[model samples]
Target: MPIEKFAPISRAACIGGGVIGGGWVARFLLAGIDVRLFDPHPDAERIVAEVLANAERAYGLLTSAPLPRRGRLSFCASVAEAVEGAQWVQESVPERLDLKRRVLAEIDAAAPAEALIGSSTSGLKPTDLQEGLTHPGRLFVAHPYNPVYLLPLVEIVGGAQTVPATVERAKAVLDAIGMKGVVIAREIEAFVGDRLLEALWREALWLIKDDICDVETLDDVIRYSFGLRWAQMGLFQTYRIAGGEAGMRHFLAQFGPCLQWPWTKLTDVVDLDDTLVEKIGAQSDAQAAGLSIRELERIRDENLVGIVQALKAGQSGEGWGAGKLLKEFEQRLWAQAGHTAPPVDMKAPLELVETRVSPAWIDYNGHMTEHRYLQVFGDATDALLRRIGVDLAYVEGGHSYYTVETHLRHLDEAKLGEGLVCTTQILATDEKRLHVFHRLHAGPERREIATGEHMLLHVDTSAGRATPAAAQVLSALDAIAAAHAGLERPAAAGRAIGHKARLATPA
Candidate 1:
């Protein structure tokens, strides 16, 4: 299962733009945000470009259809300009409390009051991170795992000062950026992901230090068993199924006997001896040997993508997934549209129009007004997007365009009932922008009536800014125009394409 540009993030700001920060920036950009980077460190541009390239590839693995083009990323001279009107500011400075405080202060000062400021602090609580902010209520801990572009979980926890509205808005932002965020009801140290992983880290060190097994062996033990299940469905949910209809109570009763046993012990901490540390670290390196970090990262991302898709498909251990819910959404829309099937020629192009006059077009003398000619050309532009792409399906993915500029020239006008026809021509296109020229003609007379020029920019709905069209779709548009070029342009009302992916899998 897959989702293509599930939601959109139009504009975002990333404060640190280092490895992790750069990853965060890439994730936002790929989801169609015009992200601003505010890092002062050197090599910032190099890191961001690298991360962006990797993110595009990772996003490709998640879906087969064309993904929206990577949004433009700019390196701002200061944090203030980078975050001034941003809807979301992701602060990823070094985890020192003092540094975090300074960054938060700057964001709170510069960002819009309605904007949400979140820190990517792994273990820092909201109070710790927002200690010096002007309005700490809008600040919260939004800890995302490493390699954020591929992994999708972000743990959100807030302090006493945090407002629930801000937290909910942050969650909506996360959804638009295609990430899962779990909001912790109460602020806690270490947050959820670290707390869950800490238990495993302690036990893994014990086996290596006690000479029971090597690091590779211990990792394999869990990866072969628990890792597979955890990927598709978490442990608690898995146990619910294990208990049958009796649920948690039955599972607890069955496992209660082992509570007193030493199988599980959280009170003990294993000290890492120097020799053992060297041995395991080198072995771990050996296990990961011969591959560059980039290569390893690609492999890891591919695996995660496959696992996540499986979970979404309900074919993995999780018996139910998002695909089922989405089918209902599709079915609901289909029902609303009625069972009556649209004509197969709904996408057919009319060769010509015999009549184009309307009551609104008539003046006192029943002659068509000059403005009506331009109106026909304007309608032609709408016909083009639906023909090329950006139909209902693309719009649902938050991929639509707005005309920023237009120029019209009217050559002739006819009587109220006179015939008029129109033709559209593709002017030019790039990753994020499109330009077109349209013509309206006096039908059968073979005389030009009106022509207009237009320039449009793709937009992301969530952040309310321009972004680029998806790659595969841009290519499809090119192919479509090439096919129709030099052929008589036809009327489009009877020829609109439906808003649905031809073959894209749904999640």
Candidate 2:
């Protein structure tokens, strides 16, 4: 099926409200899909609210892309009410097969016939859950990792009666919302990820039970060692690299014989007797070192953000793995902004960029740093260029505008979380050059925070020298310059560095 044929989900229903369900709500709402949620727990609202807050904080640190406005959220009285008009329905009630089956049946009866249903069961087979459903074709397992808002992977599993089109549509929706969906070829008790995870978990339990290592030591082993490699490159690829230039075959040959050794007790099950349970619980408490669960979640989220950002900067900024998905998501967001942006008044400066001061942009003085000012101005310049038919495709074709000279005047402070907007005026333009001025304003009052005057040269990047821009770009630039010709020039336009300002006498 062609991916473009599937419309992005506009509304969704979540039929539970614990950790996993709340995470799903966060992901859907952040993607601009309105959500109707149902959960009978007395504190369901509070739980989801706390989770949403954490998700929001993490996303603030995630990317600079312009996210669509958050979708509205409403609590529903029951599963039937929640699924009334939802295009996508997610069931996260619990892991028990009977409970899931009952809920799935309820969702099937009330949800729109065309609505896609996803079960968040960690290990239950989709076949078992869809047994009595009226429309089994649209139901599938979409198991996700913990902290569903942050983790990108969703294991999409289909059952005997599942339709292939359903899987295709699910993948399309997942892509639109910035997620990776891997379709399982065959259903099993536990899907691929958990199967691998269960094996490791079994061994870890045995180790703890036998007193070979404490919980913290075991965690440190993974986080400090192969965990680093696993973040960017999964197990197989990491092993391929470890094969030392000869690749997977050589590595397999060297390590294949070790599989026969009795190094691991794979089949052994640790009895969760009272003594063992208490021992593990005590060690876990000590490992936490008095930090609350929410605190730990935030720390984990911050670390994940840093790692993902690093990977996004990998391969000379093209991105890798999940970072690659993020880069593509940001590109789509930029394209959406361009299309949905309101028509500007050609007679005034163009409001080219609207953004908030991110957490990372602050310095020790609790204001935007010196270099970040340049970055924001550069973004404004890019927005202007994009406005005039200069875009990624144009640059990829070997031409772009390069900033040659810039003069900046700092007027006031831009603190963290402040909403900022940048307006660009084309002071003058020709086939080979563009002279532009940008004013950055902060807060609802639109107080001017900074001014930047820049001189840009059109260039054929391949030739490494100045050149005249294409005809379309020139035409667009001409129109903007003509509109701004009657406006007064900014005072900072011709200022030189180190120009002294008059000081107030004995303030």
Q: How does each model score on TM-score?
A: 0.63, 0.86
TM-score of 1: 0.63
Best by lDDT: 2
> Can you write out model 1's per-residue Cα lDDT over 1-507, one digit (the tens) per residue?
122222244778899998789999988887667888899988899877887777766654453222344688889999999996687899999978888888789889999877778899878878877676789998989898878986777899988789887777777777655577789887888887898899888877777777789877887998899887776568898888888899988998998788899875567987677987898888889888788778887677656655655555574433233333323333333332222223222223322122345444566776667776665655565555655555666778777888888776655766543456665556567777876666666646758776667788888887799887887668866774565555544333122234253456668
- After superposition, the stretches of candidate 2 with alpha carbons farther than 4 Å from their true spots are 1-3, 343-373, 388-400, 407-427, 430-432, 438-452, 459-507
- How high is the lDDT of residue 132 in model 1? 66
Query: What shift in Å separates residue 503 of candidate 1 from its native position after superposition?
Result: 33
Number of residue pairs clashing in candidate 1, backbone atoms closer than 3 angstroms, sequence gap of 3 or more or interchain: 2
Worst 10 residues of 1 by lDDT: 344-353
Clashes of 2: 0
**Candidate 2 lDDT tens digits, 12-83:** 999998999999999999999999999999999999999999998788667766688899999999899999
